[model samples]
Target: MAEKFDVIVVGAGMAGNAAAYTLAKAGVNVLQIERGEYAGSKNVQGGILYAQAVEALIPEFRESAPLERHIIEQRIWVLNDKSYIGTHFRSDNFNEERPNRYTLVRAQFDKWLNGEVKKAGATVITETTVLELLKDETGKVNGVRCDRENGEVRADCVILCDGVNALVGSRSGVRKEINSKEVALAVKEMHFLPRDVINERFNIQESEGVVIEILGTVTEGMLGTGFIYTNGESLSVGIGVIVSDLMKNRINPSTLLEKMKSHPSVAPLLKGSEVKEYSAHLLPEGGYDSVPELSGNGWMVCGDSAHLLNAIHREGSNMALTSGRLAAETYLELRDKGQPINAENLKKYNQKLENSFVLKDLKKYRRMPHIMLENKQFVTMYPDLLAGAAETLLRVDGVDKKTKEKKITKDFRSARGIFGLVGDAFKLVRAWR
Candidate 1:
């Protein structure tokens, strides 16, 4: 006889864990499988977690989860060769009873989340890969086939929370294969430093953290961005570029990361830190147009597998958790209604996402990916111009303020003609809308 379960969840990442925990807690028999040796084993380093999303799944996570720091300040930098222009938002409000955001080492946090799933009574099997989706006579997904002998496991439904690669779904013709242009390849490094040194450099007290996002020249005109995130005793730094841009520019991501770290403004923060880990991953940056079919008969897709990332806001985990919760909720509701997990009933998953901030946010910035791709000036020309303007305005070379302003204006016109400037502005406005 074949093994059977109420549901089979593939890949025990944020979305998978969230869905499995929710289902098991509701007394639904769920089998959660992972390819890694253990949960989070695949994650080599760090990221920021928007607290609200995970809190909805596990309210008391802040108390026990391996959170690195609570973000108290966020800085956005536009950098040239030697200098940067930027703004920051910091507030004591972030230190309230329940902080809004946090820095987390992905390995630790994911293991913790998976532990919760196990405690909730879900059967979790690590070091197991689901080779393909199993279909019934009517051609609906109802189980998965694993690598082991007699590995077929039947379930009423299957939930795919695989990462951006999403191999099983794509192989089964359930979701489209990710396009190189729609995704980004990011290289990240973990620089380990002492707690005191990290605190001294970022000017924060214990438990408080800072995040820095950089753009312009770092990618050498490629459409990409770099970032530095502070952890408890280390810093997470990395750079990401569109795969197509990398191919067109013929640039290596590692070299770009080295350049970003050596920038005068960035180097000092990691003067003597040791390199702890390095890993690369793909991100879904294609915005709304790249999202594939999310649901079908006896199956649902969530998280990066569904292209649910919001690149504009740099949010992924929040969307992952939200989608997973919604998928589980949809399954429970439809089952209660005595409805089969058919194409028609599973669309409640889509309806729930559309009604929530997930789809709404992605739809609002649907134009940004194209805007970034088309406008090279935003990445290269503007940063140098902003730096030069700042230098002129701040350094008194005995030039009058009016003359300096006129020179800056002339430079802008010379670099990007008046029409070009207007067009860029219009595109920005439209994209932002």
Candidate 2:
């Protein structure tokens, strides 16, 4: 006879861990199955963990989780070849007791979270891949099949927390396979830098770090973004491009990252830094337009598996954690009321998400991806043209202010043409609105 769990959660990433942890804390028998050699071993690289979301699952997690650094500053840069127009925000309040966010390496964070779930009475099994869902005669999901021989387990409810590949959800017919355009291929490298060097360059004290989001010429006109995040003694720098664009352009993501690192505006900060590791992963950028069925009879989807990433803010882990927690809460409520797990009841979970920031923010930025993809000027013409204009205006050539203004107008018109400029402006405002 196979063992049974009150709830079976697939994929031990942020979403599955959150769901299992919540369910186990409620004293339910939860089994978490992960395909990686260990939890998070599959996610070779990623960003910092948002404080509020993880803290919501484990209130005192701060005291125990292996956090990298507290983010005290954020920078946004629009880069041209030799110059970047940017803004930097540094706050003392961010260095206070309880920072809003902290940098994290996914490998370490997921291991810690899995341990927490185990401590909370959940059974965690790594190197165990969930093959497919087992349904009863009535076509209701009851359990899952595993790669291991005789590895069949039953549960009242099953959660699919898989990553972007998300086979379980697809196999169960909960959602369709994602298109290349709907996904992003991200490449990142960890550069080892001395603690003092990081602090000196980024201007921060111990435990305080910086994050820079770079756009424009860095991606070589590709629809993507670049990022550099400060860790304790290393810098995490990466660039992501739409997979479809990558396929069309025949440019590798790693190559794009290399180009960004070598760009005149970006090279100086990374000078003398030693590259320690390199990794690439898929990111869901489909926004509100691509989300599919979130729940079904006795089943639910969370995290990248459900296409929940908010790429505009470079936020994925938080959304995953939030969705996972909500799924677990909904399960507990239904179980407590002795209600049956079916399609009709699981709709409540979707309803809850619609009212939450997860869905609201995605809806708010629904047009951003299409807008960015359509307007290459945001990535190309604007950066170079603006940099040239700035250089021309600031040079001590003894030119009059009025003459400089006329020269700038002529330059803008010459670069993009008047009609193109107006069309771009109108498209930007319409898309944003």
State which candidate has the highest lDDT: 1
Poorest 10 consecutive residues by lDDT, candidate 2? 40-49
Q: Which ranges of candidate 1 are over 4 A from the true structure?
A: 44-46
RMSD, candidate 1, Å: 1.1
Model 1 C-alpha lDDT per residue in residues 240-325, reported as the tens digit of each score: 99999999878889999999899999999989999989999889899999889999999999999999999878999999989999
State the C-alpha lDDT per candidate: 0.91, 0.89
Give the Å shift of residue 398 in candidate 1.
0.9
The residue pairs that clash in candidate 2, if any, are none
lDDT of candidate model 1 versus the reference = 0.91
Which portions of model 2 show Cα errors greater than 4 Å?
A: none
Residue 380, candidate 2: Cα error in Å is 1.4
